[model samples]
Target: MADGVRPMLMRLRRNGVHVGVFLLGAWAWAGGLLPGLLEQWDDIAFLGWQHVELVALSGGAAILVGVPLGILFTRPRFRRAGDIALQVLNVGATIPTLAVLALSMGLLGIGNGSAIFALFVASLLPIVANTMAGLRAVPPPLLEAARGMGLSTRHTLFQVELPNSLFVIYTGIRTALAINVGTVPLAFLIGGGGLGELIFTGIALNELGIMLAGAIPTALLAVLVDFIMAQLQFWTIPRGVNPLR
Candidate 1:
């Protein structure tokens, strides 16, 4: 009990620190530390909207592609193919995001479309790999029991395998989300609007406050999304399976 409690306490402390830092930064920014940045709040709001839209578009694509591919690969007929597929995905993941973005921009001619495509590719590996791992981890006896009970393959998959694997699957998704949020800023490089617009603009103008104005919001958005996902994970996971809960 003490061991578990210690980690929980530590996590709380870390969260407190994050909140403190965010508040401090907001105070500085609002108090005229950056003479003209406050005036750009409208631009910040618009860019933030773009940032979220890009993440949503790319993340949705990753999930749509990754989950089905993961399921298909796990089938008995495709086990070998699954192995090969995972390796290919691993290679895709290993490629630098900027390189992918650059290549995508060349092919798609820049803008949000290219950015979304690049981010989708970057986010796919984790979802696929995690889904595969989660499904594979299902106990053989549990599957046999389901079969003995005369459950249809489809029913068994949806009711038993998917439920059992959801925790790990969500972990992968959460990871992908984090990656997507962090990567979205790079969209500005390709004329795909995001907080990166402010950041890069700040760099060009040598204004630290302008950069912070962008950076703080981006960081906050990531944290907020991560927290929401964590809650979803907690609620979706079976109580029996969730040791922490």
Candidate 2:
């Protein structure tokens, strides 16, 4: 427990800027800088839930596709093709997410479907990249040891490679989810309902209170998502592989 607390404290120290921003936002709210927020409690709750659902669906799809695709890329059988695929994904990731969203809107013709597709695309590259890197980072000796112990190839992967690599994979998921939370607001442009409704509306009307109503919650959600994923990484990673342990 002390080990965990130490790391968390260190992290907070390193992230003082973030802590300060959060505190400042809280002060603003308490000071009634966002009076409109109090009146829109129901909208905030409803839209926040919608925002969470969008993130979950998109982030889940990215993981389902990215992790396996990453593993395939790491395999000797697919090495050459994987390199090409990685290049493509890297390039795709470089394209601004808004552009991806715009293209998705064009193809899918608006709504939640387009938003999900765009977010999934935006989130895939990191997961795939990290998975491949994590697998490769596993010491070669570990693979030999597993084989010498009579572990089958599949068994070696599930019992050895994946367990060891989960920390890095989870980092990728954490990053992707952060991006998802930030980007989901753009979905409002396509009629995909979320907290962005208040944000965009506030922007057009130049209403600071309305804007903060959406922006503050979005920022808080990003922090909350990262914290949750970090805790998951701490608990799920093998103690032998987890650096924090």
Candidate 3:
């Protein structure tokens, strides 16, 4: 317990420093941060909420679909197909995020639908990949032991395989969410409506304050999301499998 606490404490201290530096930098660059933030407070709040919604919708869908698909891929019946699918997903992941958004916009005809679909595609590969990897990484000895105890396939999967692999699976989720937060800004292009409105608008008008309005919040949001996910990871992952423990 002390061991885990120490690491968490150290991490918090580091995060504190990062927050401080970020604020100091913002203050220096923008000068009188309050006026700028307050100037567009209404837009910032509204757009920020939109940004969160985009991430939640896309990231949630990825987890729901990716986890099951990954589990299916690992099964003997679907292993070959899974391998091919994973290869395809890997190829898909390599395509630029903007291109994915453009493709979705082309198909979905713009709006939140296109943005969500694009973000979902970008977020899926890691979850599926990690789920498969984690399941396969279960030690052979454990399988033999479970079999010796006459555990059924379903029992082995739920009681044994998933528990062991949960840590890796969580890591994948964290990665996917981070990607979602970062990529969400692009959704504005497809009329998805997010913080990107301020950012791009600021750019167009050459207003540092406006750009920082969006950029700063987005950066803070990314950090906050990652932090929340980290806490979830610590609490939910089984202690035996949890590296932090």
Best by TM-score: 3
Residue 155 lDDT (model 2): 96
lDDT of 3 at 216: 91
Pairs of residues clashing in candidate 2: none
In order, the Cα lDDT scores of the candidates are 0.90, 0.92, 0.93
Order by TM-score, highest first: 3, 2, 1
Model 3 residue 66 lDDT score:
97
What local lDDT does model 2 show for residue 53? 95
Q: CA lDDT of 175 in candidate 1?
A: 96
Residue-by-residue lDDT tens digits, candidate 3, 1-245: 99999999999999999999998878765777668778899999999999999999999999999999999999999999989988998898789999999999999998999999999999998999999999999999999999999999999999899999998999999999999998998999999999999999999999988998999999999999989999998998889878898
**Per-model TM against the reference:** 0.87, 0.88, 0.89
Per-residue accuracy of model 1 over 1-245 as CA lDDT, tens digit each = 99999999999999999999999878876877655556778888999999999989999899999998898999899999999998988888889999989999999987888999999988898999999999999999999999999999899999789888989888899999999999999989997899999988889999887887788789999999889989999987888776548
Name model 3 segments beyond 4 Å from true. Answer: 1-30
Error of 3 at 146 (Å): 0.8
Candidate 2 lDDT, 82-128, residue by residue in tens: 88987887787789988989999999998999999999999998999
RMSD after CA superposition, every candidate: 4.1, 4.7, 4.2
